[model samples]
Structures are given as C-alpha cells and as structure tokens.
Target: MDDATARTQLESMLAELDRSITVLRGDPDAPGDRSLADAGADLTDADRARAMLDVAARQRTAVLDALKRLDSGDYGRCVDCGKPVPEGRLAARPEASRCVQCQSVRERRR
Candidate 1:
C-alpha cells in the first residue's frame, strides 16, 4: 500500500485499540470470586482480554515507530538489511522494518 493507505490503516487500528482498551477497562469480570464455583470461563475471558491488550500495545508501538521513521525520512528502508522494503511487503505489514528475508531469518533465530 502507499504511505497514505498505510497511515490510514494505522490510524484505524489505533482507534480500534483505544475502543478495545476502554471496553476492557470497563469490564467487571474477574478471575477470582469466592462465591463462584467455576471461575474458569471468567479467567479465560480475562486472559483473552490481556492478550488483546498486549496486541494493542504492540500495535501502538508499531504506529509510533512508523511515525518516527516518517519524521526521520527513513520510512521505507529495511532496518536489518538497508534495502528498500518492497511495496507489496509494506502493504502486507506497514509496521515492518525488515525485508522478508531478514524478517524470516530474525524469526528463525528467535
């Protein structure tokens, strides 16, 4: 995608994340309740919320990182290999800082 499209997507994702965080914060369910016999499902829900929050947090970080790159005039270069990240890859993952090969190698190491 183009920079405009990527920016739009990031904005939308950020707004969705904010809404999700608000919902999670307002949620009343808890993992522990002495009055309840089975808190398994509630705990699972809490876990799911936690996982979602983590994802949102990462997305936020990616947005910030992208913004920083934009400001630095280094938005499209691969961080790992100093290559220009292809438009197709950027379309797939606007937050990506590495080319596919570098990303694959990094993931393998991790």
Candidate 2:
C-alpha cells in the first residue's frame, strides 16, 4: 500500500489499540479509581486481565513501532531479512515487523 494509505490504516489501528489498552488496563480517566498506574492489577480476574493487558500493550507497541517505521520509510520491509513484506501480509497485519519466513524462524526459536 501507499504511504498515505498505510499511515491512515496504521493510525486507525493505533487508535483502536490505545482504546483497548486503556479499557483493559482500567480507565485512566476514572475519578478516584485505580488508574493505569497498576496496569489493571486491581481488576477482577487479575490473572486474565493481566494476560489481556499484556497482549493489548504489545499490540499497541507494535502499532506504534510500525508508525515509526512508516516515518522512516521502512514500514513494509521485514526487519530480519530487510525484504519487502508481502502486500497480503501487510493487509492482514499492518503491525508486522517481519515477513512470514523470518517470523516463522523467530517463532520456532521461541
């Protein structure tokens, strides 16, 4: 996708991830309540919320990183191999920093 289209999409994803992180972490704007300081440690099912919060935070970070890469003109390139990531993959996951082959290798190591 073009830079403008990619920026628009990435920005939209960033906004959604921000909202998800805020809600999952607990409303930071909530008055006299457990704000984002604890990262939703005070919520019911602390364990589950912790997992969800972690996922959301990771996603938010990925989206932010993608935006940064976009600014640097590296958004569509795989971080590991430095190859152009497939459009289909980017269409499905704009936050992806690695292409399928590199990503598979990393997952295997993990």
Candidate 3:
C-alpha cells in the first residue's frame, strides 16, 4: 500500500486503540467505574483489561515507529538483517520491523 493509505490505516487504528484505552481505564461516571469488590469476577475483568491495554499500547508504539520509519525512508526494510521486507508482509503488518526468517529467529530466541 502507498504511504498515504498506510498512514490512514495506522491513524484509524491508533484512534480506536486510544478510545479503548480510555474506556478500559474506567470513567468515574461510567459503568466501568464500578468498585473492584467482586474478588473473582472483577479480578478476571481487570486482568483481561490490563492484558488488552498492554497489547494495544505496544501496537500503538509499533505503528508510531513505522510512521517514523516512513519518514526516514526505512519503512519496508527489516531492522534485524537489513533485508527488504516483502510488500505482502507489510500489507499484513505495516509495523513489522523484521523479515519472516529474522522474525522467526527472534521469536525462537525468546
């Protein structure tokens, strides 16, 4: 996809994630502000919200990093091995910083 299209998609995602983060944080006047007194249920809900928040935050960071890479003319290149990342991969994950093989290696190490 073109940079403009990618930018639009990323911006949309960022907006949605920001909204979700806000809601997950629990508004004082909203239903989400209920006390965490139900030990079992509230704990589960809070845990899930925390997990989602962490994932969304990481995704937002990645998208922002991708935008920076675009400005630096380094968007579609693998940060690990300096190889050209495939357009298909970029289309699927515009924030990817590693090619398939390198990504696999990194995951295995983890």
Residue-pair clashes per candidate: 1, 0, 0
- Which residue runs of candidate 2 sit more than 4 Å off their true CA positions? 27-44
Write model 2 residue lDDT over 22-53, tens digit each, in one string: 77777546666456856556554567878998
Question: Judged by lDDT against the true structure, how good is candidate 1?
Answer: 0.77
TM-score of each: 0.79, 0.81, 0.85
In candidate 3, residue 28 scores what lDDT? 31
- Stretches of candidate 1 off by over 4 Å are 29-38
Each model's RMSD to truth, in Å?
A: 2.9, 5.4, 2.7
lDDT of each: 0.77, 0.86, 0.84
As a whole number from 0 to 100, the lDDT of residue 67 in candidate 2 is 93
Collision pairs in model 1: 1-91
- Model 3, which residues run further than 4 Å from truth? 28-37
Q: Sort the predicted structures by lDDT, highest score first.
A: 2, 3, 1
In TM-score terms, which candidate is top?
3
